[model samples]
Target: MKRRHFLISGAAGAALSMARPSWAMAGAPAYLTAASKEGNSTWLVGLTEQGDVVFELPIPSRGHAAAAHPFRAEAVAFARRPGRFAVVLDCATGKEIARLDSPEGRHFYGHGAFTADGKLLLTTENAYDVPDGRLGIWDAEDGYNRIGELPSGGIGPHEMIRLADGSFAVANGGMQTHPDYDRAVLNIPSMKPNLTYLDAQGLIVDQVEPPADMRLNSIRHIAADDTGRVVIALQWQGNPLTAVPLMASHRRGEALAFFDHPETVRLKQYAGSIAISSDGAEIAVTGPKGGHVLFFDGATGAPINGRALPEASGVAQFGDRFAITLAGGLLEGGASGGKMLDVAGGYSWDNHLVSIRRV
Candidate 1:
């Protein structure tokens, strides 16, 4: 501890400064997440840059991902997929300020993103009865009200990212399922997974689809670098023994390039999470089923390296490298080398992790 204590002090000061006007002092945003302990207690947690826990608040149910407000030290914790509830909390005070509920026939897909201006919140929703994907809009300036929604361009929208040009990219997993069926995929013979780019108003700008033979590859998770290049992770819905690419990168006006790692065959065709390094030069991904973390070159489909982390699922930027979260703890490598860190608090980590920059 000496290092922990020092970083804790700095983080405390940062938290205090966040309460003041941004011109007076700007406190960097802490990493926020939802973690569970033995499936009993689920919490939304904040941590400093050095992996120190700053605050933890018990959520009513399991949370899959969270999005931090750009200006205020606030966060919104999303419930797991097929969920109907999400909680908005004040990170500084650890209080629940609001709750977002799905409309009568729709449910959340457990992920969301905020615009740079922080004026609106966007979420992926599924109209189970009508069987379509939607982008739920909320009025941030007006108390998180459900303002309206727009079409998400395809079915089973899982994750999305805002681009540098004020647009959105969605990963349409292309599988149809209803909560009543308990995660049983309803469509397989004609599953049409696609990566769609939408304008800020939610109009389809463009879309990319895999070839005829790769339809079983579902686009589930996504990450983008500072330069607006997007990388997507795939989960194979085909046979267990068949091997396929688990990752792909997309650039505007260019075809999607599948990362062809001769060793990707070992991933078992499942990647739970995806994240880019701080410098935008490397992409990191993790697989819970295969118990491994792999890195790919940002510009090429070449595999840089790989590491093993049993039950590893979450991948996020950690300083110069990326961190992997598992039941045992958090690993700070998966790039150069793997080093264990103590941030799990003896809890089982969920599938995705993200870094937040306050101010």
Candidate 2:
């Protein structure tokens, strides 16, 4: 169980130079990211729209999510939250391109996004010393160099989505933590999570938080459509028996609207991931702890469908349908049909399926 860290070797350098023009030779995966585990080893996986693995590159540890280069056959797999390493892979050649190491006193939150132009990489980070959330900017053309940073407008920022207008919508989870405590929530009772919208330059354009009584809901995952409508998946830190909505939708200049689900469709107060359909008409959120996936009408904030699945975790948009993965390695769809494909090699899909749609 030796740890693997990919550096920029000569072969990897060659792969990087030809990555853009020859990506089709790399299988041209439609949905780029989802991590899989095989015993003690983990890999950053790329899949076709039909859920076939196109490329699998070994990573240092478990990856929570990945950020795909908009047009190149490159991807960055981020380590689990509070983990400091993110490996950049040359998917076209199945080679490790480079690694991003968070600066001391700072750690990644297991998610990132590439600017639409593919020139910059933005990763959600925790400046743990100040206990503040940050967006670490990287120079994509310059070996993924750490270029600058921006305030995330809250405490613990997790997943982020890039809007069509070149801004970003960040789910600031708001619970403070440090490596010393190892994921322990230091401020749950006082935690105040918000969805903060920022421009390309990282200035807060707008932000929204839950109403007074719903403050304990932690905004952890986020999804957005082309029209700028954003959906959020929340993890409740309050009493598990308390009935509360686990998903919400919002647009700029409008109040946050939480989707209502039947009591029978209990989300167990946790939503691991959220995704919106291509047409922006439907939304899906997964509650792995509750063993269910729930869909909602994107515009009206109404629950459309719910299904029970064992260990349902990562979810993403697959054309007009939704692709979901369970902890047992089942890749399936919802509403339209079921069971796209199953991953082999003792690999189980991890949290957060990211779609690598063309920019």
Candidate 3:
């Protein structure tokens, strides 16, 4: 991939002086996300699991999500989907260390993950001209250089996560989009969203899709539990009133076991984000469009419980429970039955809430 990389003017020295040796410094955050306030100002934020803000760094534009390095106090904040840029920040000093630009005809899909060793960064991308999905590999240990690319095994790969065994799983949302058309779905009738598993080298090991009848259900967001079973969130691209299965769980070499309980139908045909409990026993799917958060048994795909939360936008594992973010700056459910915390500061949380686990 041909692109430009820049160290923020004059911040290089500060980065060298203040960069932490590890993520054990005071105020090391447990979660990372992107938020936006008035006038389109945006920031990549770090927070403790209990809703305390650890740090916030400015970004050039609205970001979709961010990838926290497993070992370092650094993050790569991705511009919203189809956006051409991602900024790398040195969290210890709150400095912009580097900038990544997509090559011609390719754009970031708004999400990425660092390898377990924190030596490599793998990002989801759109080879839009080919209408294909690509994984951009970067040398995280060497100034975040773009080293190579890999096929994503399908089209429209959105979110990618490193699995327990060092492989990866990706959600290929399947609806083709191009920046020229500005997020318009180009092939609704033929859309075939799928969840694909890749070996450590990025070769497809296994892939599966929703039942043929649910072909229009776009597989967008995904989360993996401790056992390597993946839970996926879907957005219906067909009739809004239709009650189709919106969540499913899968293990490689096994068929997708869907969670089609009655509550799923109430999600308004869209699941905006998903999370698997740290213990691998529960799952949460947020439907901002439907105005609710639904829980399910992580192993069985059965309904556990759900709650109505207006404009709920992001969800991630927080201890035994899940932390949820709502529009208007409200963060709740960080701990089991925990009270709500208003951290909005006039900014709304974006689509994904990422946990920064120690390697």
Candidate 4:
């Protein structure tokens, strides 16, 4: 089957307007950025507190994910093309400030974060056909220059998080695909997935792999706590299709333990996007295939609560509230399909950022 084109065009703009609700008329823009899968563009949909889109700004590429600088108002977005780099957009003007590309032809695997002082930008890159990936370091303050690339230590380098201690923790999902976007003859057999730790200079400081029994569980996204404890979300790749869900943690060169999701077999198709609360009190993981966002007590890995969303993809934590992006019901299904559902009061089908505050 031909892969679906994920871009929104000028013609669909009118239909998108019709999908807007009356509630979109009032309030402050609650969302900062929205990734429009159908448009293959990231929209700066200005929103109000009342969950309305005030205005819209189109980004340059088909951005899968974005990271807002911790201190500055700028953000960096990643595209899927190998050897392709990220684009820096001015949040205030919605203009492209810089285009950061990789020299090694390694496409960024959709993840990036700004350093504490806002001087450094860290991102992940993976070769579509190669065994190993790379960690890219860039100078954020100076035109987003490529400083160097670090060994990602695994197959598919998906996401990375900066720890409080200044080290970096990366979740390297072990799977190789065709650089030309060809799925035929692409899926490799018995790929080994692992987690790697590195310092600011990109040297491998530590690493961890899955147990022999669960080698196919690819560690993809990750979130870290104040104490250097890293929580990894796993995506399954192997067969049998009926196996336990493996979620694990790593800290100080020791693997604490791994917790299995109660509904492992049922959650096999879910892509894991993990987030830790700002206070380090709660850890949340979104399973889009399972239609649920599962939360657990940070310290014990015990289940706390889980909420159902149409198709949750991204999860983030503000001060005391948790925010998530609900894409359309189907992962690859386009907007015209009946599978897409309208959000209660916010945006639709396209990626929307919504926050729920704790009472």
Instruction: Kindly list the per-residue Cα lDDT of model 1 for residues 215-331, writing each as its tens digit.
Output: 899999998776778899999999978878899988888878888665576678888999887766678878888788788876675799887778787788876677777766677
TM-score per candidate, chains pooled: 0.89, 0.90, 0.90, 0.75
Q: Would you list the C-alpha lDDT of every candidate in the order shown?
A: 0.77, 0.78, 0.78, 0.60
Over the stretch 101-190, how does candidate 2's per-residue lDDT look in tens digits? 999889999998877667778899999989899988877777988867778899999998788987789999989999999999999868
Candidate 2 C-alpha error for residue 93, in Å: 2.3
The per-residue C-alpha lDDT of model 3 at residue 125 equals: 95
Judging by TM-score, tell me the better candidate of 2 and 4. Answer: 2
- Output the TM-score of candidate 2: 0.90
Encode model 3's per-residue lDDT on 1-359: one tens digit a residue: 23222111111233532465556763467777888878879988877766777778888787887787777777788999888899887666567889999888899999887766566788899999897999888877567777778888788999888888878899999989999898898999889988998776566789998788888988888888767888888888998878888888888888877787667766889898998877767788888887888888766778887787777788887667778887655455532355677674666778887766543
Clashing pairs in 1: 29-358
Query: Which portions of model 1 show Cα errors greater than 4 Å?
Result: 1-29
Higher-ranked by TM-score: 3 or 4? 3
Shift of residue 54 alpha carbon in model 1, Å? 1.7
